[model samples]
Target: MARWQPKLGLVQETLLLTLHARALDAKLPSPILGDTLSAELAGAIDYDFGRLKVKPSLVATTALRARKLDDVVRAFVAVHPECVVLDLGCGLDPRMFRCDPPPNVGWYDIDFPEVVKLRSEHLPSRSHLIGADLTESGLLDDIPGDRPAVIIAEGLLPFMPGDSFRRMTRELAGHFPSGELALNGYTRFAAWAMKYHPTIKALGIKAAQGFDDPREPESWGAGLELVEEQFLTRAPEVALFPQPLRALTRLTARSTGLSRQGARILRYRF
Candidate 1:
């Protein structure tokens, strides 16, 4: 059998990094996300994950952040079983499967045409996959606006320019009557560090935008109100880390300023 080789652009190819991170976590005895599907999908591909040199901390952080997002989605769907879920720039991640929203929920995974094609071929999903550039107009027209919606932008925001990001948030907010928007946020300092980080540099990906304040998005006219900001370092999952890493995370968790420098999951109600 031939290994699947990914033909993706630099930005799109960065999905492999998160995939690798999840795969690594799946191997742990007490995994944070326990996404063995990521490991299976990763193994089927021919790409060389060795070159990324994905560290343990990276894997733990990725899984922890994903789990945090999953918790938010699960909680939302529990209350609004008939909601609509739009996973913007979803890439190949099987978030719908992880969240397992009720049968009444409508799940849509949106991404570039090429990536959507790849997802259709590799990942098993019940989601309605839409192939389109998120930055373009009329992309949101296909999504139903009658129900409450949950818009999740996992790794999509940083790649978007500031103006585009603002416009997207506002458009999405306006599309739904009321719902939650969850995303992994990067502070300006974290964005800078991402550029120089060995793994990120290897992928030739740089974050196009970052924010110092979680509440800044509210000013974008999205009618978005900051609900909560979850710092991964402070999450209970950190206890699953190795001894040294766990201690370091606990120490950093003590300071809001220091924890903000790492990964954060931000939730907003619109």
Candidate 2:
């Protein structure tokens, strides 16, 4: 059988890290997200997973963050049954499968052309997969603008340039009638630290932008209001982690400052 080789750029290549993290988490005795599809997708690829040397804590953090995002999506979809869901920079991650929105909801996964092609060939999704770069103008025009929509940017924001990030947020806000934007956010310090992270450094990727305040996006001309800021280190899902990891998370959970330096999920309503 031929291995699934995806032609993705440097930034797009980072998707494999999250994919591997979810895959590793699924192998755990008590997995946080339990995404078997991610595991299968990771295995199907011919890339060298050993190069990443992904840590168990990183795996736990990835799963916990993903689970939180899934919860947010589920909650929104529960209320707005006819909403349009746009998974921006949607890589090979099977988030649509995990969320399983009602038939009334229109699900769309947007990514680079090659990545979308890879997804179509390997993953079975009911989502309308679009092949386009989010940074390009008129990208939002392809999506339904009249309906209420939920825009998810999981591991995407950090890699996007500051100007591009701001423009994208504002554009999304103006594109949809009303909805929410959910994403894993990084503080300036966290973004700097990412350069030294083993998996990140190995992939030769660096965060293009970061923010110290969760509410900072409100100034991006998006009319975005911070709905919630969920710090993963202090989340209940930490309890599901292995012994030392769980204890360490509990220790850091005591300080809001300390937890902010780690992974956080930010939700905004536009």
- C-alpha RMSD values across all candidates: 1.2, 1.3
CA lDDT, every model vs. true structure? 0.88, 0.88
lDDT by residue (tens digit), candidate 1, 42-133: 98999989888788899999898888888888889988999998888888888888888878999999988999999999998699999988
Q: Which runs of model 1 end up more than 4 angstroms from their true locations?
A: none
In Å, residue 192's CA in model 1 sits off its true spot by 1.6
Residue-by-residue lDDT tens digits, candidate 2, 1-270 = 357776678888888988999999999888999999999889889999889889988899989888998888899999999999988888888999999989989999998888898889999868999998777778876688888888889888778875888888888889889999999998988888888988888888756568989989989999899999988887878889898989999999899999998889999998
Full-model lDDT, candidate 1: 0.88
lDDT of 2 at 103: 97
Superposition TM-score, candidate 1 onto the true structure: 0.97
Clash count list over all predictions: 0, 0
